[model samples]
Target: MTKAIRSPALVVRAFNVEISRIQDQTSDPQTAAFRLQFWQDILKKIFVKEQVFQNIPANPIAQELFKVSSAYSLSKRHLEKLITSRRDLLQTKLFRNLEDIEKYADDSVSSIYYLLLSVANIANVHADHAASHLGKAQGLANILRSVHVANHHKTVFLPMDILMKNKVSQEMVLRGVNTDDMKNVAFEVASRANSHLEKARNISVPKLANQIFLPAIAVDSYLKKLQKNDFNVFDKQLQQTNALLPFSLYFKRVLNKY
Candidate 1:
């Protein structure tokens, strides 16, 4: 499904339209102002962000999206961190261990969670809970998706606790062996991260789970596809279904009602 919009241009349009819709739903001047400023920041990040969109092959669509989005200075400091730290991240060798990996995590998508808040029409009172919950979900999903690629690069991502308990070594992970303890360690890392996710949802705020709704459902959809094909994300051969997002819209609606 993926929003029924495959082309990169259409995808950018879809995201812009969705942001506008969320803003209209908010209908508050404060929310409106924040939304405006927030998206302006996102657009800026789109072109300037080296981690996600850097090295994208030159194409008409890529040029258009980058041109339109990278127009302003990001308002949040962490969003600034994503921009400022772009050079540091390029030096992959520096992040050779778990501690370094967590720092990398903080640099990349954890900061993106800050941008997601900037764009969403969620309010101040709800901000803390909203951010924490949504961040953990997105962060976990990101870490899961990029696990293999990261390991290949000599950057460590598994929690320090899991690494210690399982007696796994950084060199072993980079070597890419799927040891039993390693698999268990990865699962434990995810499970512990989910526990943090649950903690973030403890508050009874309106539209609290809305941010994570689509991602959570996408995770389930991806997991099901993996099961059917006898594939796992860590194995790298299991690709996510394009239809995942379309079926996930229903779940998003339900969670938004939270």
Candidate 2:
């Protein structure tokens, strides 16, 4: 939370949001791929030693990212992983199994943690371990929350394996079916996310990195609410924002717990 890293962290997060929204913003797969390529090319230029900032595109996010990357000696591979994962997601919208989703979470989510840790100069394995589990937890929770919207787009992000195991079909989800089978799938996915969150909390990370993991509280809160709603991913109550979340996060941050 020091002033030194505040701007860099914000820039990195802004970059993540931009990359994540590409799929939602573009209807054409080719357009999405092209946009992802633009990021990839930007990353390459950002990492180049000869002309570090000279050839950077006229994009604010790219420009700030280059500055942070140079200032903090951020990992090029970690930054590249973010774009590559999004590119892969563009190519394969549906996951085959829970493990596939976890891998996607690691690539798309954990890479952010890795970069943040680098910015904070934290090199502990324990911190990285916690970040890995936390990323999976947050990523899975995000997928659960997006079920309604993804279905509206005629796309299903629930793992195909889980859906098959629960006797739920993609069409069923796309049609916004609120059956017991769909609830079962949600329950299973939520349970997996909960397990990862528990594991993350069990680890001992550096105090400096605690703030970085505050998203855990949000993930934990959503899972609890999902359970209360009987694991219904399409619950209208789930769509409403938690007004107390800000207070909750502030309390946790004050307690030095993530």
Candidate with maximal TM-score: 2
lDDT of 1 by residue, 28-142 (tens): 5456556555545655556454636554445444444553344323234654454334335433334343445445555544455444433343345565454555455545555
Q: Model 2 over residues 178-200: C-alpha lDDT tens digits?
A: 99989989998999999999999
TM-score of each model, in listed order: 0.54, 0.98
Per-model CA lDDT versus the true structure: 0.50, 0.90
lDDT: worst 10-residue window of model 1: 1-10
- Runs in model 1 lying further than 4 Å from the true structure: 1-76, 84-107, 150-154, 208-213, 219-233, 236-238, 254-258
Cα deviation of 207 in candidate 1 (Å)?
Answer: 3.4
Identify the candidate with maximal lDDT. Answer: 2
